[model samples]
Target: MLPQFFPPFADAVSLPESPASSSLGKALELLDLFSLTSPLVRIDDVIARFGFPRSTAYRYLKELCDAGLLAPASGGAYSLGPRVIEFERLLELTDPLYRAGQQVLQEIGDPGAVYLLHNLYRDKVLCIYKQGPDVIEYEGRRITVRRARGLPFPLFQGAGSLALLPWLSPHRIRQTYLRNAAEIASSGLGDDWEAFRRVLAAIRRKGYSTSQGTITPFLGGIAVPVLLPEDRKLVGSLAWTVAAGAMTEERVESCAEHLTRAAQAIAREYVKVAADM
Candidate 1:
């Protein structure tokens, strides 16, 4: 029999008690515990976190191992498995935004700047692609582009997140505003829904958004949304980041112009590709 594939972070309590469903739930839960800061996990760590019995944890881990979702490492540790590499490869192959965004970045984005393509997933801005300079300094440590992908930013924060706000329906906008009112207020956008709506209106009129040190401390960004031409639906955002000190008015305007152009090109390509498909 073929092994059942488990969706990422599936809720265990929601699934019916078929053997595959039961096993898949536990496997997904196990995988959810892995993250950039904690990439490797031991059975004891899982036990400590989830309070699962040793045998039960081992069973779940073994199932994931057999399914190629987790691989054993030294000292009884397990890291994310080769299947993740395959899944990312499949994502790049299947996702239109990645290809179209790459083209947009190459054409309009500054070669030395940091550019990110973000999509709204589960109400958060997920960084699906990142293009960075040869050395990017984050919190005084230099990192590469390969290390920056897949990082998620909060939906109600950052220039990229603000760029997407105007595209949401009024009801969703109000809901999101209410859910994140305090944070939004703290960020100086608004203290209430009315103020927030005004801010979004201004962003829509300008065709882009800019923020200083909102997502990453000491960094600023300018972002524009990619909208589908036919239905005007929001697909994602294209954003460029620079050091906070370098975000002069002229530089911000220039970045916004570049971002807007790239966003328009990406949207056109995305719609064309979708129509062809």
Candidate 2:
């Protein structure tokens, strides 16, 4: 079960995440057209998806390629470009959550575990920092700390995602429940509002969360949320995962103890970082 805090993922909910309102937003949404299966977006794909006129499609493509947010690929397609990597590098050098959580993880490094930090970002839980093998092969399937680094993920599953839920504000929680009831139900967090609250309440009362391969196969994780004491808001989560083959109940309790303490230190550092801003 998850906690009942008002939804605590990233920026405040600005509803209706579709039909990019500005030229810039529309152009950026074009980037969303590219994915693993469609790694190279062609002009027709953008026009078909966004319904942009032919001339506007070409212009947008040219502008994106020129700006290095996209690069022309073989067969008249475009792929995300070097600027994306540069931006990722820049964020790592400066994002406060990543900075604080990663330093703390270094202090508690374990060869057999994967340390992770996740936070809300525009209605999704994003793994902001990960210290582990890039991919773990389990049951002939390849999985990583996330589907892909830098990709946004739905908040309905995973230890990192579930752990942060209890610290959200009540209104946010209700709003999230309303908007994502189906997903919430499917996730087994609850099938109804009261049930959802009760489930999350149980997680909250426990002071941490655990998942048995809910988000990944053959791995179990224990997670603790990071709350800025002065702000009284849950901002993110810290978690560590261990392969089920090697996991034991004792390890879960010990990891919870270690993560709880690390989360506190990271929260304190977070306050310092916020102050400097």
Top of the candidates by lDDT:
2
Distance from true location, Cα of 26 in model 2, Å:
2.2
Superposed on all Cα atoms, model 2 deviates from the true structure by an RMSD in Å of 4.7
Which residue pairs show backbone clashes in model 2? 2-200, 3-200, 5-166, 5-168, 6-168, 6-169, 7-173, 10-120
lDDT of 1 by residue, 43-93 (tens): 998899878899999998998899889999999999999998999998787
TM-score of every prediction relative to native: 0.73, 0.81
Tell me how far the alpha carbon of residue 179 in candidate 2 is from the true structure, in angstroms, after superposition: 3.1
Summarize candidate 2's per-residue lDDT along 181-269 as a digit string, tens digits.
89999999988877888888888888889887777777777899998878767889888776665467788888889889989999888
Each model's C-alpha lDDT?
A: 0.77, 0.79
What's model 1's TM-score?
Answer: 0.73
